[model samples]
Target chain A: MSDVATRLDVLKTYKLYVGGKFPRSESGRVYEVTDAKGEWLANAPLGTRKDTRDAVLAARAAVKGWAGTTAYNRGQVLYRVAEMLQGRREQFAAEVAVSEGIGPKKAAALVDAAIDRWVWYAGWTDKVAQIAGGANPVAGPYFNLSTPEPTGVVGIVAPQAGYGHSLLGLVSVIAPAIATGNTVVVAAAADAPLPALSLGEVLATSDVPGGVVNIISGRTADIAPTLASHQDVNALDLTGAIASDGPGAAPALEAAAADTLKRVVRPELDPFAQDWTNAPGTDRLLSFLETKTVWHPMGI
Target chain B: MSTVAANAPGVAGSGLQDVAASEASLRRFLHGLPGVDQVGLEARAATLGTRSIKTTAKAYAIDLAISMIDLTTLEGADTVGKVRALCAKGRTPDPTDPTTPRVAAICVYPDMVATAKDALRGTDIQVASVATAFPAGRAALPVKLADTADAVAAGADEIDMVIDRGAFLSGRYLDVFNEIVAVKEACKRPDGTSAHLKVIFETGELQTYDNVRRVSWLAMLAGADFIKTSTGKVAVNATPPVTLLMLEAVRDFRAQTGVQVGVKPAGGIKTTKDAMKYLVMVNETLGDDWLTPHWFRFGASSLLNDLLMQRQKLTTGRYSGPDYVTVD
Candidate 1:
């Protein structure tokens, strides 16, 4: 064997995903990521409130076209994400094993389950309106129909810590938000942000439009307040906050979100301990949606 | 016509005098004015826009911006009722609070000039009109001249005239210069008082920053009292860098000729934050001299309500919604 190794692996530089492009945080700050053994993994961009603001701008700009897309077309695009994630299964599995201190078989299973979760939500995209909306029986000579529409931009606090959950939790929160036609600004898990950042790359190559999914990797405490209080953000998901900042953080964020009357989704259990492989309920799908009832006179 | 001689004291021999005399001189004058570094200008404007004006200064800027607005209605569907409503809004922007200072002027189409003047009668608020085949400037010289004459005859305190973009782009510099001079003469009333002439470059069509700077000097040299950025009708109207270039031109013109010309950046400036950024640029670039409504104005329609909402927030310490403000 040679005394000196000739080759070295080129590690990826994780960046914030905004407006469909991967850019370094505007503050030029980064945090160290490590494996379960405490070895240095990579430096992830420490996003700031400005990054959250830029993400909100991008999300708001994307609302009109993304919401106007046919449900069938949205489903096809989401399925395309699954197809791309499946191609990168090995890379994600390896990362998950190292980050979560799991064996290869468990990592593989986790990656498979995450991909299948995407496919499940992909199928739900077309059927959500049918399940959540219906005709409202009203008195008098009128026909009324209640249809669900996107509530504009939604801010997501993805569950951090632990490899399998970090990746799957992000997919769980984000797919439902966007599948229902709302654009999302996701604050990915802080310690285990590599998988989420890599997913941003997958999203870019997939058919998803820019600005539809803006992912920021940073401390949940630092980014969540800005996302919650932002006047333009229409909704928020507090999954990652409950995981990273303890249960007390969610209500503070929820109270701050009340300033703008944001539609908030609070977690029922510890986000880090949830079994992401199980079938997700329809509550996530109904979180970011608003129902609009249309009335028409029979004589018309 | 004699106003050109009166205004051309220090401006002469600086190439502003003989711009229309020869094509070579006009080319030399325009080309001789410093070349614009696009990247540097945009960076400087973006950096200035980051300055945070809070609390007391925010209130001051909001009010200053409100006072500088030229409440305008130039749509094809504008009617006498619309003009009257705009006039009332201009007179008292916030009816609940009489402390709100009235706007500087009310701008409208030339045919509505008389209605605007009648509605704004017995007040210091000026009735400005867009004239000289405004927004396009594609008419014959006689028709353009008559357009200005008609607005002036209808008691328009100010005439906002569009430069012939076709002539300016094709290097007919003298035609553009003389057209401005003719409009300046047409702004003069029979009673020996001339309405202040504002020359609009329609800078969106005049693509290059170099063109914007050159035309600024051209309009000022030809006896224009104010040099406006756009007609508020283009895809890109009144960007910060374009307005910054005009502010620089006015500063330089004042330094050379000892004549101060006002700068108005019209269109796309819709929010209080946007107006505050422009005011910050003006404050830093030209100092407090241009901060007054006499030297700076925003030709906007919807900007008033936003300014009012922000002002209410400043006074009440709570955010106000759109429903509280009246719809024009």
Candidate 2:
């Protein structure tokens, strides 16, 4: 060994990101996170029902400010987020490799795909309105126009099953929601939450304003049910619930969300089916959006 | 002018009346009171705030907090219709739930008192009006007394008057003490009853916990029915330490004179959680005797809505949103 004292590797205390601040769960609970093979990696914050309540509140508060930002500015902000992520690629790849129990090369590839997906959603921000909204033909002296608007605060659950690509799947859900100017309270993949928590750091450093994207990593049952039934949460993406907390989680959450008439993105039919590597279309972006139509009397 | 009625409910009896007989005597008495230890007082308040009150207890606290609110609208732009709406809200609170308790009072400006009084005619809710050229007590003695008289003439049940901070800061203790006495005199009506006088210290401008404690004693000695913290107009209004110091004063004051002066911490208190903290402080400090609407109150407008929302959350398992509440 060398005579020089060895540098102690610094470890990051992963925390839940709410309204742009990294706060440990209010309950001060933490649980051991492990690799796919059950080897302990690190302890992640064990977010509770209160955390979901707080995240939704933060998201709701940001809805007006975030949605009011011009679509062009939102696009620029997402692009900036992607740039921030690109610089942190090596850090995230190492995290994904351990959390997902994958080879380094595969983890690196997934990180690259996640960064590219942000760019893809960045391009969609200004264009989705064009594709989804347009001028309508009306009878007599009136001109009707339609535009797509964000569907307010959306609660998204990242893919949590073992086969799911952690970083790619998380980026796929978050980028689309924020690109449409909808602030999101996301329940990250429980089993492999390190990458997701790291992503919060990336988003915070970028141009994304506070509360635009809140990420929590913990037991899906504890976090997701509250978000589903929260009146402030306008919509919920129940993707992680399909495999997390057993078979009944998704349907139970769907029933709870229906009580508030929330616009829910139901889980995929098969939990172990999709590899999360499929090319993403505008469906994720459009699902969390509402179409607003205006009518103007034609002037002489 | 310094003579106070021994039988007055909140004013410490004739035993303490001789203390304010002159400027020198009042100064000696106020200065004789114990100085506040700021750091310990703030830390104690913070510790009390962390007490987890959940489930049914939270539900009960929410209702109690609602009943303690002096649902207020002191805006210059306040109209009859707005005051009417506030009155309805104060009375019913959550219209969907009949079990929701009505507030302790409806607090408004002097001009809006008659309209509020007319709107809330039969309810037990008192109409408390802020007078004494309120928010700022910069007016002359005649103008301040007239302001108090106007609100009382408009059928106000309680008069919230501001103390002259300039006089208090400049060591003119007797001037401030006598003005509170004059405003107390102005609260009298033709029916031989007087409107409850809530003496506001505007403690944010007072600048020290020691000053807050001093004012609390001075106002109580001057025959104030209630000692209020702030007028809700200044930047740093109604902080926990200041309120705590005032609460300590009232506790000590009541012990010495057998008089229980109410405490109202107004301004900057908006959330149910913050309200709960204040309630916890009160329950722990003064015990159950001061818990009633007769002895304690919150001077707030938005605070009522938050309490209602927390009540709804307890009733319905789902968390509530701002959209579900009234805009006012």
> Which stretches in model 1 have alpha-carbon errors above 4 Å?
A1-5, A161-163, A243-248, B1-4, B7-107, B112-127, B152-155, B168-174, B189-193, B204-214, B232-245, B267-285, B298-328
Candidate 2 lDDT, B101-150, residue by residue in tens: 99999999999999999999989999999999888888999998998999
After superposing all C-alphas onto the true structure, candidate 2 shows an RMSD in angstroms of 1.7
Which regions of candidate 2 deviate over 4 angstroms? A1-6, A162-164, A244-248, B4-14
Model 2: residue A277 alpha-carbon error in angstroms: 2.1
Cα deviation of A139, candidate 2, in Å = 1.3
Per-prediction fnat? 0.00, 0.83
Full-model lDDT, candidate 2: 0.89
Candidate 2 lDDT, tens digit per residue, A263-284?
Answer: 9998888756767777988899
Model 2 compared with the native: what TM-score? 0.97
